[model samples]
Target: MNTETTNTERSTQIMHTEKQIEFDKIKNIWKNLAITDYAKECIQNTEICLDEVELRNRLRDTTNSKEMIEKLGTPPFQNITEIRDIMAIGQKGDCLTPYQLERVERVLVVVERLRDYLSRGKQFYNSLAYYDENLDALPELREEINMKIRNDGVDDRATDRLFDIRSKMISVEESMKQKAEQTIRNNKECMADTYYTLRNGRVCVPVKKDYRYKIQGSVIDKSSTGSTYFVEPAGVAKQYEELALLKIEEENEVYNILYTLTAMVIYAIPVMEENMRMIEKLDFIFSKGKLSVDLDCVEPQINLERKIELTKARHPLMDKSISVPLDFKIGETERGIVITGPNTGGKTVAIKTVMLNAYMAQCGLHVSCKAANISMNSNYLCDIGDGQNISENLSTYSAHIKNVLEILKEVNKDSFVIMDELGSGTDPAEGMGIATAILEELRKSNANFLVTTHYPEVKEYADKTEGIINARMTFDKETLKPTYRMVIGEAGESCAFYIADRLGMPKEMLENAVTAAYGKGAISNYKFKNDNLKKKEVKNVIIKKRKYHKDTKLSTLYTIGDSVMVFPDKKIGIVCEPVNEKGVLRVQVADKKIYINHKRVKLLVKSEELYPEDYDFSIVFDSVENRKIKHDLDRKYTDEVYHYDIEK
Candidate 1:
């Protein structure tokens, strides 16, 4: 085959394989971290938690729901279907609605109430509780006593005694009120001056003028502002008065309230936190649930368990019923499996089945296997098939060489590698030589590999190497369809003549070609079968698989609004429409939607993909919104399809 033809075939195979592992439910084991019952219920119901308010508050407070969970513990609130549902009735965006804003105000009100109750618990003897103005009437009391004496209510000696007593009363009252006022003022200032800012090269209160003097002492500079006052320096008398009120008994009451409220709010942290974590998981599940695929007769597995076992798998890209699964195995002694069969004998599909499934499994996706027991090393390398990138100024030969080199770099004694056709871009002698050398290297490396080749050199290697083996996709010449089945230890027999006859090739032309090919030794170059493998047989097998899928009825056929499952894995996707005439169901996952055939759709079985083995999950406490950048390719490349930045 020409290099161009080979490249095209390879690219087609790879594209198909990639499509097989649908991207949306492409195996995210991270989701299992949410192991709590609340999380499981949410996923199972395909319902999101409405815990937006809790999360919003945590975010506003520069905290996360998960953080609180570590300190305080789990939440107490029962799961609400939607925390944001009520808000949903409101408009969305950065701004809040009247009702939403009211909620915020209520939060602030609660804070104020808490502060009030704390203040009321203060003790009479507590320095912080003393009222200063009431304590400053000593002088006035003494004056009143003197005035009474002047009114001639008593003798001169009596008046002197009364005046002395009044003087003493005035002195004591002034001391009490002065000290109480100073302590109260200090507390008020502490609350008021909680925040500050820098302005015009001065450290100033970050409040309005009215609040400034109370919060931060009035500035003494006269040049300061239109509204300015000087606060008298607090003195020793004021300090003594504050000290007199410092009784532990009195202070304890106020501390008790502070401690109680803090404990109450802090205690609710875990529950609130749990709800928030659930909401995040819900968002992810819902977002991912949008894409859906179908599963049917495709059961392809890896031979890690001495025998390969795969069941009910589907092509990720093809409409549901069209994907067929083939089950077979190659042994350890067989280092390489060479698959060959007639044209359209599902040679490509079988090759893709092995390669793509391996890729998906490594990437963490659940495979389309009912029982999958794949034992594979970490490194997965593939040169399945790719068309040459003409735009890259590389020809088929060059692209193949590059791909081979890339694969070789990663291949090791234990690596699993799949190569479609080793070398086919040049002359037959040179091509066979290159293919033979490559096979020799792979065999020597003792790596587990699979390759599809029409070259004699590859077949020869399979015959000679102890660990190498040959497998062929069976083509019943009587049935025109490639049976899509596999057979081990057999060299594939080409049915070219049979195919030509079935397709109604001209008798004279067929005869002439056969003679020419035989004379060229092409007929004897490899095995060829001349028989009738009717198309009807191929069609029947496909129909049978489809019927099996249909008869295996999922509990419900998804409708426009119903939630559905995307497969090869179970993911929540919303059904956008019922099955169309072609048996294809359309669904949306996230922002993307595509039509899938019915065979792949199944009633959501268990809600989760059970983990493979011992797994540890860490709780994630943050949310990140998806970032999408729309690229206008046409606009970006106005002059060319491919642009290279030589200058850069």
Candidate 2:
């Protein structure tokens, strides 16, 4: 295989397939099982591996870890995941703080323990013991660090120079105390206290404020109340200065000791860093084992041939009790399966389970199944879910179309693809056409895939195609619920009519719906029965009429009798019609009834305020001759009425 091409394809697959299969969720599970931050980071950056030897090696290590834990108990893997920065500090020529050095010591201790643990069972765990060869014990550095450092500070015996400096400072401090005692006794009457105390790193005797000037010493610090002063005895003043010098020397020696230890650590930085990496790798390996035990997983039989056969496979995220176990296969005879089922019938879950299992197995983790005979693929591409991009103003169907187009561009025989609800979220006729054409194109690509659809025509195409098979999520008509079982070599009913019938929809309407779906004669041939159970059956019942309170009052001034001015025409006319749903209105403009939009007509006057109650608008709207013809028609029959209507 071309390395560049294979890497490019895997990158694309990781970009698109993670969220669709919730692979990150599985990673979170792995992360939680890990004892070290190193392992967690390793898990986060893991790629879906397809290399046969590399994948087998990782799985073998994981299996070894699982057995090692079962027989020998948990390996003493410390949570010293923060060793990277500690090593970086030493490598950058900075002295490691006592705390940070202890962390490095911790890493070394864990390495030693793991080696010993694996060695004790070397006869039984030869593979596990193989890591001991590359691992350098680095006993000199470990022992030096352990001896020189404490939890909080460097030990006094860390260096001979530091030890001598501290010893001389102690002797000088004792001599200063003896001299201060003599001065306090000679000036007992002037002393504020009998004991000598420390003041500015010098032994001092507290004196009364009035007698501070009389004391044979220099005042260093005074009490807050100003009644007493801390004075250094003049005899010990020179000795205090000498002890201070020794203290400075002590600091320099301590730094020298720390620097020497850090130099040794820096020399071994390369080894320790490599050791840290190995420890992290071992942590990740054991974590995979822990996840295997938690998920009750089995090693999948990875094959070079692109065939998938899984038995009793459950989605790793779902509860096993509630989730239906899937037995699915492809690439043996059929290259693709067209799944047809009603809504929420596990069609989506069915495909997702198969895809996620194949993904996990390829990554060298045990799959959650009794048996997973899987194949390695260059990439697994799926265009599942709505993924509606609201910010970009893309609809569900538009998103699906975009994703499917992108998937189609990168599909191949080594590619495992899954598409759900193909040709949905659009006009049925056009969507079905686009779906069929896309399927044919996919067939040409020879990619092993699974497609779910509600289009009956797609089902027919699957039945006739040689490399395609028809599958369905079984539904129970009697219970009006889905069984959530996948059956091969059969097509499924949408069960819309049965569900509607059970929901109290009239039988005639369901029959009409069937007719509309499959055309006129399909209703008689449709297989469904009306539930006659009186308690559960739908019954015709009279509904009570209601008038809800209206919240919005009309603001428009167009009334039947109101005078309105027509725009551009500038003719005054009585409003003869109310605004319709289209906002069109009728206005009698001088016996020529004009049809115009409401926007063109404006209210000129209020009829209720001007016209009297029960007023006859004929005086304002009709001519005298036309009124006489209307009065004649109301009292007696006449052909003159036709002339009146035609003239009006």
Candidate 3:
């Protein structure tokens, strides 16, 4: 398949999964050291294969001879994108400059070196020499270019005539310098500093401005202060002109040599292009080998049968120091696995490890595991994270369902799907039903799938369903912490109360929550009734509420008249009622009243400090005018104004 198609498939397969990020990270490492853009592109487009003998052979060759390969180090492969342009130019009978030809020469040297390196050991690197015949080596071309071009990219001693022309130019220029120096010495009395300098590419003498007419020559330049005049003596003018002409001839000769070399390279473009492809392929292979070594990876055995047996597999992108190694399996006796675990218990990490290793195996790279026996699937699919699309106005559940629909449409018998927290983010009952139905469909198609969930009903379904098994992340009940270990054939219990208690939740509150979830009976008892052993007696058990001892200091912390601010809600209120059995206080804010946990309200004003010994609470609880109106209404109300509002 083409790269676009492969990328689209992988995008859908691991789009919401952690493997998406992990894959990019792996590709980035390869791109960083890649010699050319084409080589980097090859790394990106590498895909898993099932029956590619040549690819496997190359991988084996590199892996087997890694040490020897490392000895050669990285080859000097330069960017050759402009080579195509140069070739096009030469095809139209145009010549290339020395700079362009130098680049081509450098590439040829690299190609020749790589070919020689690989050709050294005929057995180990034999498979990598697939393009050896196509590469011309072009030793003659390399020699000719080296002879004509200097290491600094200028023309060297290539042709005898060009060399002679440069020699004559150098000697004539020296002669001009000597003549100018002699002229300076002869007119030392009229010269400014007795120094000979060059101006306008000709030797000149610095003559004093007052004696400028003493030197009979052309004026070349003058000092900024105008105290001295730079003069090119008439004696050396002809020799300088001859030097310029010789320099022009030298440039022409260099161009001819460059054109000859460029023509030679253009003629061998076909073979050179083939050789470049081979070098890129080799670069890509060695990169994989280097990554394998870096990640402590091992080659996994590929099987036609659908199965994944990963032992001590760790997420390649995670911190190795603290990362938990996963031992997971599928498609042996069971085709579907439902992994139930608490949050942050390595469930997502486990799923990513499986998917990434599978992708790596298919891409012909070694996987990060001690031992792996992975089955080749037609497609690798997953829905492992929040796929929310805010711009599309899609909720997390909608995004998840959209991905599931796409996966369902594309999955086949040889497909592998990994879903994290399946049947979540919606109504528990309906979501569990939908998840069960989807799992049934996947099982019916014989597609290998692994799903993680928090629903008890899903776990029960896995317990009863054929070819489906339940797994869980191990939790330590005493420590109230997850161990991040996956255990098979067991359903995990959600120890919310224990965890909450360890996090400093109130003991009474945790007890009530646990009782509510597990029922009031702390223990179960069996009794026989009606003279039959099968019929059990039913007893009405009453659970007594625990009473708290009222401590004087605690009870007086917030009194009836205390002004307080409710936390989280941030409302100002006065404590109108005493603390209850639950340590919650009833506070009144303006016209509204709310009951808040004692710890959730902060005392702003103490009752003892804010009120008098025999204070009338009505003054603080009600407005002054309302209190006055109540007083008038409570009385006989003899006046008309006070009596008018009594009924209203």
Clashing pairs in 2: none
Q: Give the backbone clash total of model 2.
A: 0
**TM-score, model 2 to reference:** 0.75
TM-score, model 1 to reference: 0.40
The Cα RMSD of model 3 versus the native structure comes to 12.1
RMSD to true structure for each model, in Å: 30.0, 13.3, 12.1
lDDT of 3 by residue, 1-648 (tens): 999998887765654443443787887876776676787888776655656574466447546435445555554456667766777887788887677677777888888877776666355454554545656667887777777777645564788888788889889988998999899888888888767997877788999899999888999999999998999899888787888788889888877777778788887888778877777666776677678767778888777778899999888877778877889889889998888878877777777788888777777778888999888888777886788889999999999899888778878898888888887787665788889988888888789988889887889999999999999988776676678788878877676655765566554444444443444453132111112223234333333322335654455557788767675455778887778767777788767667767866666556766678878776655556666777877786635332222211
- Residue pairs clashing in model 3 are 48-362, 48-363
What TM-score does each of the candidates earn?
0.40, 0.75, 0.75
Could you give candidate 2's per-residue lDDT for residues 505-594 as a string of tens digits? 666566655643454557677665664534434443222222224652233436678766676455778876677767677778886777
lDDT of 1 by residue, 180-263 (tens): 355345555333333333333222332334544443343433325544232322453343344344433233433343233333
User: Clashes in each model (backbone N, CA, C under 3 Å)?
Assistant: 45, 0, 2
